[model samples]
Target: MRFSMHSTLFDPDALPFRRALIAGIACVAAVVAGAMLADQPYLIFAGLAGLVYVGTLTVNCRALAWLVIALQPAALIVPFFPGRPFWWELCALLAWPSLLAYGLVNRRKIEVVAFDRAERWALAALGGYVAVILGTMAYRGVGLRIFGGEQMGGRVYVQQLVLSILPVLMLLAGFSQKQLRMAMITGWLLSLTYIVSELTFARSQDMAPLLYFFELPVDGLNFSTGYDASGVRRFGSLAAVAGAGLSLLWVAAPLRELLGRWLLVTGPLMVALVGLGLGSGYRNVFASAICTLFFLAWVQRFWNPSRVISMVLVGAVMVGGLYFFAKELPLSVQRSVSFFPGIAISPIAKADAATTNSDRVEVLKLAIADSPKYWLFGRGFGMDRFDRLPVDDPNDSVSMLYSQGMFYNGFLGTLLKLGVFGLLCSLLFVWHVSKIALQLGLLVRRRTPSEWSFFDRVCLLLCAQWFAAVLLFYLTNGDVTWWMQSFGLLAGLLMACRRLKQDEGFVVDSDGVPKASVTA
Candidate 1:
């Protein structure tokens, strides 16, 4: 046999490949049985989901896995208009059965990567938190109703657990270093696309229709030309802004030296897109993005003596330029910056900003007030706003009014729902992941520029972004576990990569092929 480097990348005869194939076949058999017996039309959706996931697992293509992961943000952000199912949930939900089947069949092929001390502690904390939630639910009874209002049985509890755990398990079992790199690239590209689309369509008369078609929020319609009713267009709302900010951190990090020279041209374009996207009304997103950049720079040692002068000059120019041109800047952009700690703006704008800021403060206050009542276990996990809202409500305004309640300050909500103990565990989990990301960043920074491969560098950046994304999301939006789970999956894969040392273990290369050095 020839010793072509690429040849080992896709060895179908490999045990993992064969095991994945067998599991897929079993899934197909089940789908066929379901169709024959149940005769439900939705079985087709299930079949499609199963087949695609089976193919991805068996093929072990890093590109395919990343394509799916990259689309996750869009799936979450994109609207699920009237009569449409939230495809993001559907996509995530349908993927689990096939992945579990593959995992069981390939159980022996699965390498149980040992968690380091910090990771072990993190996992233990998370497990304990979940146990507390479940215990409290069991004792008080689980329900769609808050606290002791109504006991709806264990259906919601079980569903929340499944939803939360499925993605984490999939990432742990399915992803590799190569997929992580591709996910970073895809995430960046998608974020760029989102900003470009938002900017390009901001002034269009048909903006609402276009956004509706894509299931994006139309942002209000009462504002000025090109502005949403809130006087800003939050293309993907805070999520989109947060995603872009994370992407920007990657673009600005000291890691740029490791990326290809081509990024020199592409890099500025990305920065511009992101900068323009963080307009007025996106204070939280903007703050998160700025804080993350500072964090990345500090960790990467962006303040080395050699670069101090350049850093100061650049900072001066950015602040000065914006200050000088503040009036001429896009209203949205100006409004975005107006709420910064010491920015000055018109009295009306200032009042508007004050009102907006107070909403969050009030929500936090409300959460704090409610926390003491159920401080031990917190409100039950996965309390959906839709479940609380009447399905028969004729008031079109009800959805808008209650939707915000769905995610009210996610960080505070977590504290209120899970109690201080659960919140501490959640923070511990985040700390562990952040520690790993910081380690990766420091390692990458110390690497001789030429020694760092495309795969390694991108993986590091993505892990960092994933860490930042979760932190920003947790502190602000706090919703379902999907986004957090995505980051956790990234963290898990990054940890695996670190421990396995791709060149040593039975690891696949950047091309998704098994390395020749890895023997059975």
Candidate 2:
């Protein structure tokens, strides 16, 4: 009763014509794509093309993989700015139509959209964070005057508007399995770009040796340096700096597989990483890098325990030998060419040498003392100044309280902002979503088939990035920029992942490409 003419439909020799078409498609797609997805029409077209592409997916993976990994950073990043001459952007804008068009050509069809626990948490968190931030603003008692109404009271309601709309746009993007793979590959490419630029700044080197694969002119970019002297690395998009480090940390690690052990030598990716570290000049980047590595190592370890133990043992032996030699060395020798200080026995200690831990801890304590207020609708959102007047506060606590506003606006506004119901839901959502991602990650390895796909891996990466960024942001800078952008990206990424997971009809090849490949 089967429709196939032969029993060996999956056999390599059976589908010669289909395979050839797929191969031909792969070779020509990139060369043909020379447009950008700019403006509202292009964005809509991009979404529709994604819809069509997902529908036509057939599963000849080799070529499919090529398309997913093909996008260059210049294609996406440049168009966001006002003026940039890039044919690639035009191609990206137009290529989407081809994906949809492929469905009509081949007639394979699928209907899919993704939704899951992470999306729910993102929704809850975005609401809660905004409410709390705005509530703090209102509690200062000039809430009405600042906005001229009961509106958000931040410095710029505009970025807040962007933060609000971004999630909706992502939801509209209509994620599919192919999209997720494409995104991860994109993430890897961009992360590599950022790291390379950072490293160039550090060593004062040419970007060609670092990012020559794409032939981008990487010279003279400010961040061409590493971690940054201020221990920060801000991105061009938004005033935020927290997530870029996490992104770099991640894209490099999973990317190591693509590079293999040869990354240690003169690999393009390796050069980019080195340039990022050197260019930033910030020690915090090093900390974030360590955290990223440790997380990756732990994840890999979770899958392969014996390999973990062996690596740990080897590392311990090397450290012990170094310590023993340092102890036996003369003071003059130690002073001149010592391998480490007593604390330098660990890499973390060595990196922490030029950092200011005690001062940050002190400043954080000062910031926290003015918190935990009780304002139902407390301070005005835009009222963080010293009451726009000179205050004579002798003590740190009093200074913080008065500087918060002329009068102390306690936690009442916090209640109105959170509204009691939101607070409870926020707590529950965090508990649930965190647990789910952790379970799914381990389950994808231990319980589910190894066929969990690229989108799954990318979602895992997004989670890892968020977690790492949260840790680093808390330690480095507690600015609103850190919180807002982290949550914003997290929200957008989650929604995109949701659409990918929920939609199942798109047939994907092993490397995360659709077979029919969008010809546009």
How many residue-pair clashes does candidate 1 contain? 6
Best by TM-score, which number?
Answer: 1
Model 1, 32-148: lDDT tens per residue? 867675576565665676667766663333333344457645523334333333343344454456456656766665446434565566567667666766775765555554344
Candidates' C-alpha lDDT: 0.53, 0.42
In the range 1-520, model 2's lDDT, one tens digit per residue, is: 7666444444556675568667887666533443333334566566567656555443322233233233323323333333332333333333334434543454433232233445556566666656655554445443223446443234333234334434434454444567556655554455445444444544555644443332222223433242343223323221112234345444443433433454344345433443344333334444555565556544433335655575577547745764676434322222222223452233332333323334344434443443344223323335434443233554543344333322211122223233344344434434444444454344334323245455555666655655565556544543332234445545455545544543443433332233332233
lDDT minimum window of 10 residues, candidate 2: 405-414
**Which regions of candidate 1 fall more than 4 Å away from where they truly are?**
1-68, 76-88, 133-163, 166-177, 192-213, 217-234, 237-271, 346-348, 381-411, 442-446, 466-486, 496-520
Clash count, predicted structure 2:
63
Give candidate 2's whole-model lDDT: 0.42
